[model samples]
Target chain A: MLTNRSEVVVKKEMSLLERIYIPAILAGMRITLSHFFKRKATVNYPEVKRPFSPVYRGQHVLKRDEAGAERCTACGLCAVACPAEAITMVASERKKGEENLYREEKYASIYEINMLRCIFCGLCEDACPKEAIFLTDRIVPSTFKRGEFIYGKDKLVEKVDKRVDISKRQTQTVLEFKQNKKFAHNRLYTDKQLKEKH
Target chain B: MLAFLIYKLILVVAVFAVSLVVAMYSTYAERKIAAFLQDRLGPNRAGPFGILQPLADGVKMFMKEEIIPGTSNKWLFILGPSLAMFTACMTGVVIPWGGTLTIGDQQYPMQITDINIGILYLLGVVSIGVYGIMIGGWASNNKYSLLGAIRASSQMISYELAMGLAIIALVMHTGTLSLRDIAAMQTGWHWNIVYQPLGFLIFIVCAFAETNRAPFDLPECETELVGGYHTEYSSMKLGFYLFAEYINMFISSAVISTLYFGGYNMPFVGRFVHDPNVLAVLGSVFLFAKLFFFIFFFMWVRWTLPRFRYDQLMNLGWKILIPLALFNIALTGVLMYLGGRLH
Candidate 1:
């Protein structure tokens, strides 16, 4: 406590209006009346979704290649990088005539993300050697079962022709980050940059 | 005689149902208004715009486990909320909701009763309000409950003196105790408020105190009194107390509107409307508008002001409000005497 803090003396005298209290009450009522018409701060969740930032980390998505094949080569960088130890996958050799199913020689036979354990930090997205994993703006749906929370490949992976919605992720922060810009600008350098950075 | 009896029954039921519904919605509106004041939306889930929220709340209250504390007066505890609610709902009879509605050859008024001693009846009912709090607190067998009850009874008694004085000033000016007659006299917006502004002010302050609203909500002040008079109460018994408060507020608003704001009489509205039934309906609407506004004002003050300390509350009620009421009465008497001589 500061010793220099002066103890202010009380002023007991109140003006006629202060004694009446009606005028002061009217003034306060005016303030509250103004707020009644002002825009409400409620989001009305479920029906109306509030826009999240582009960098907003959420549900995990396993992506596909341009040729409609699994992009993950099971390099284990994402699993190793995951702080929560939420991701697990079993790798298998892509057999003959399986080029349509998998891009690389090696492919993930089983991939599961324990959503309860998963923090959605986007670390796995950054650690993916094959650019197969991403944390989309998709909110993790609440579930009653712990088993249901451990999302399998069917839940995590994008469909063959379907595209991930990244509209919210294209916010001002992404525009300022040159790397986010180069994701659309250059694929060759992005791979090289990731490899060199890793 | 049969027709009159039937009409009275209908009017009484209509008034009772309307007051209960208004009280129910007041709970919802209070929350919404409070939310808006704090820049938030309150209860928009149960139904469209949360209109069914009160129904849901009623259901919840009814479903809750009813508790009666051991070593307490069980009958008095049961009777507490019932008395509070009974006294609350009982005040609606004398209020002039609207002028007479003439159906065919018959003329029936919108009020349940046009009791000549209407104002006196209101004051009597208001006095009886103290019993509910006292009984509930006493029966609870708790110190905090007892304190709350004492606060409630004392506050009611102190404020009632000023309130009665204020009403007397108005009675002198209007020269009638019949609420309907007083309202009819203040036709075309020639309101009693213009004549007795000071009296109106005192009355409004007393209204707040009598309703046990904020600044004087010492009885149910959650922080200090725990649950106050209703501390040991649960389920519908607790609901009844809360419900009674809102009903009291509605009745007070009606009384204030009738006494000061020309009741159901609207500004220049009488000139344009001549049909008796239509006019009566419109008057009822205008009365409701005034009631709603005054109710909103009650909630507005609740959120804006802090609770008063016991000593400060006592000082204001006894020292200031009492003298102000007396002075207002003297001023009104002088004005009425002068006006009569000039005429």
Candidate 2:
């Protein structure tokens, strides 16, 4: 009973056709010849990068407002929600002439994420109420030492000329903020839309 | 007479060079075919599409250190691969590459020698190929090498009988042993294969065995015999053993096409052109086309079929192929005697 219950077993007497062996050989040759002309399965990597999906959670991005000011309010909600305790920041008050630098008067002075500890679960992005932090499609590059993986504001902040591309962002609130929210930061897309007549 | 001798010398050198070059490329072709069969890109790094790969391989072989085992007969160890390569190259001298090359006013045959007993000379050369394996294996002082050599010699000898019998059937129809005459006789669509299909089948199967190609490749079966007879050989010496096999394959393809498929004779050359030189060149091209197809088929069957067990190899050679060949000869004789002669 144990042997019978093991797995599906097939047994049959050798037919005259199988004994001759030519037909079976011809069938195998046919399969190989078919593969010869079929498209190869190898992907030529490095030169041709495969795109990630919209729902992929990757490196976190600290967003900005219309005045090119910092968005992180140093509310500590994200740090509290982090499962890995990856995010850390020092709060600072916005000075007299820093309206263009900070959207909120109270903004984060120093923000860092220990990428090695971050599980990249998008929990922090979901937990933030200020819409200052969200996950983007940029993957973390490998480093030689564990210390290099702790990304600071200089490494995490998007450059002015090359801001974070939000095409792959699938979060519903982020999408709603882009289309309806008056103060939502979308300098790249809204300017193009205004010029296009759409 | 001196001019004729000089012409023959040139023909010999040209034929030898052409055979060696073709055999070199056959290795590259074999690798490419194997890769494609499994859907992968073969060597395309050395030069454009790896055309220079064979040259690179030859250089690598020469650069490698030579090794002769301490317990081996050094002289015989050296003689083995040399003899194998020599015998393989010798078979190409009789095959008519083209009809004739006319220069100024003198007409010269493109073949190295038009020996009266051409087919007999070929069979004799092919038979000597066994000694190469035997000597190499015996001198190596390794059990695996000796076993491979024995397998090779026995396989070659057993297959040669069937091969000769198959040829005898074709000889009865043509009434000549000269390959040139046999090829000339089968001028049009009346190739010997049409008359002796069964004979061609037996001969082809035996050819596979004689050349040590797969399905019948028991001599150097890697799983059993490691590197076979050339296990102790290294550097260019090892290259000769492997290269000789490819040369044997090239010559075998040429000989097969010459005997059964009308060597140097196109289907409709006479209808289209009358210039003798032009016809000869075109005929040579046609012959090469046939040769290339046979070589590809050899590799195709190699990749397709599994190697036979040692006992199975002997059974197929003696029990099956020999009887089939004998029957073919008897049938050919009966038809020739009863009916009018077939072209």
Candidate 3:
């Protein structure tokens, strides 16, 4: 009664051939035979993978600076913004001799993200003021142990030699904003600006 | 006489092995064909195109925990599947697979035994096959199993009538009870299917019901009765029941091929091949081709058609097929009479 799509049931008596059901069965068989020749819908999952969208959010990654230093200043903004509350970290001041490793004075010492709890919403990527955390397209490989799923900085951090390309993640406006060094939040200070600050 | 006995022994073992192998592969083919029809790749992991799937299934079936309910009649439960498997394997003996092989002026027919009343033997064995389901169902002490058994027995009894009548129509034309003679008569494009088209139609439909295949598979219908007759059966016992169904399918296909189509007769090839041995081998291959096509047809129909409702099944069996088969017999008699008068 919601719509006019429903048909009334008719009680018309069938003719002799129709009552027999051979012609109808033969017609049904013809349809199935045609489908036997048609292209199969299955994609062999392991050997062949279907393409994913460029911005498809999956596993999380911690970005490294140009000089091979950790970009995270232990701001805790990503952790606060995560709806799942999957992120947790401990802040530690950088030592005098560890300047090459740490981009900022304050950095995360123990960063852990429980992958089982993380909903892959890309909210953490949006909330990262330092542009340190990102949701990359690389899938999280399954493991038997629950403990193995809690990804540490070792698994999350990108290697210095092997950089994960995240150019597609940012929009034109965000890329344009990075060029303007007027904002301190950009974290792209010139050498003169550093000296002036000192 | 001793040499003939040895040859017969060897032939018996070969036929048994062939039927077993065919039944095993039928399961694999059913899955693969179903996948193809649904536009999906099925079971390609076990081996190249999943050829070793049946072997894996066999091992799994053997390794499964055998369960017999405490209330069940244990001896009859054991007897049920064994009887089913026995009856399934019994039908292949009488089929004339190939022509005679002449060895030093001695002829060796490519069949285990050419029983004169082969069709009757087949019908008798097929009727006995219902006992396996009935005993299993009744012995299980489950209401569903009993219902399934009742349905199966009734279905088989109803359909066998039509199937026999259909065969009677064919037999009237050939005037022989022996399968070898029937196969031999259909030489040079003179297949019985050409004459007995309507009879073949009825026979094929009844064959579907007889084998307990889809559209006629109400005995083990999953929707209403959970696992049906073999509800309480487990492990290799259950495997035996399932395996028996496939074997029945293979045998029915062979029967259909032998009776309707030219069983082992390849047209024009016999003229080219002068040697008897080579001809016999070629004949066996041709017969096997027909058997495989019919098996494929069984699987094809299984996937295409939905299972019939219980009352619809009974109605079709009793009302439609029986009357049609009777009409065919009368028509065959009249036609044969007219042809003789004309001659």
Say which candidate scores most in TM-score: 3
lDDT over C-alpha atoms for residue A111 of model 1: 96
User: By summed lDDT, which 10 consecutive residues of candidate 3 chain B come out lowest?
Assistant: B334-343
Interface DockQ of candidate 3:
0.68
lDDT for each of the candidates? 0.89, 0.88, 0.92
TM agreement with the true structure for every prediction = 0.85, 0.75, 0.92
Q: Give the per-residue lDDT of model 1 (tens digit) for B214-332.
A: 97899988999997888888999999999999999999999999999999888877688888788889999999999999999999889888999999999999999999889988888
Winner by DockQ:
3
lDDT of model 1 at position B96 = 88
Q: Candidate 1 DockQ score?
A: 0.58
Candidate 2's residue-wise lDDT over B1-343, tens digit each?
Answer: 9998888889889999999999999999998887777777677767988989999999999999999999999999989999999999999999989888899999988788889899999999999998998999999999989999999999999999999999999999999999889888888898888999999989999999999999888888888899788888899999999999999999999999999999988887789899999998898999999999999888888888889999999998899899989999999999998887974
DockQ of 2: 0.37
lDDT of 3 by residue, A169-196 (tens): 7778765554453365656676679999
Clashes (backbone N, CA, C under 3 Å), per candidate, total: 1, 0, 0
Candidate 3 ranges with C-alpha deviation above 4 Å:
A1-11, A171-198, B341-343
* Residue-wise C-alpha lDDT for candidate 1, range A1-198, written one tens digit per residue: 477788878988998879877788788878878988899888989999988777678897787777889899998888998999998999999999999989999999999999999988877776665668888877898988899999888988888768786546545664455346435455656656888988
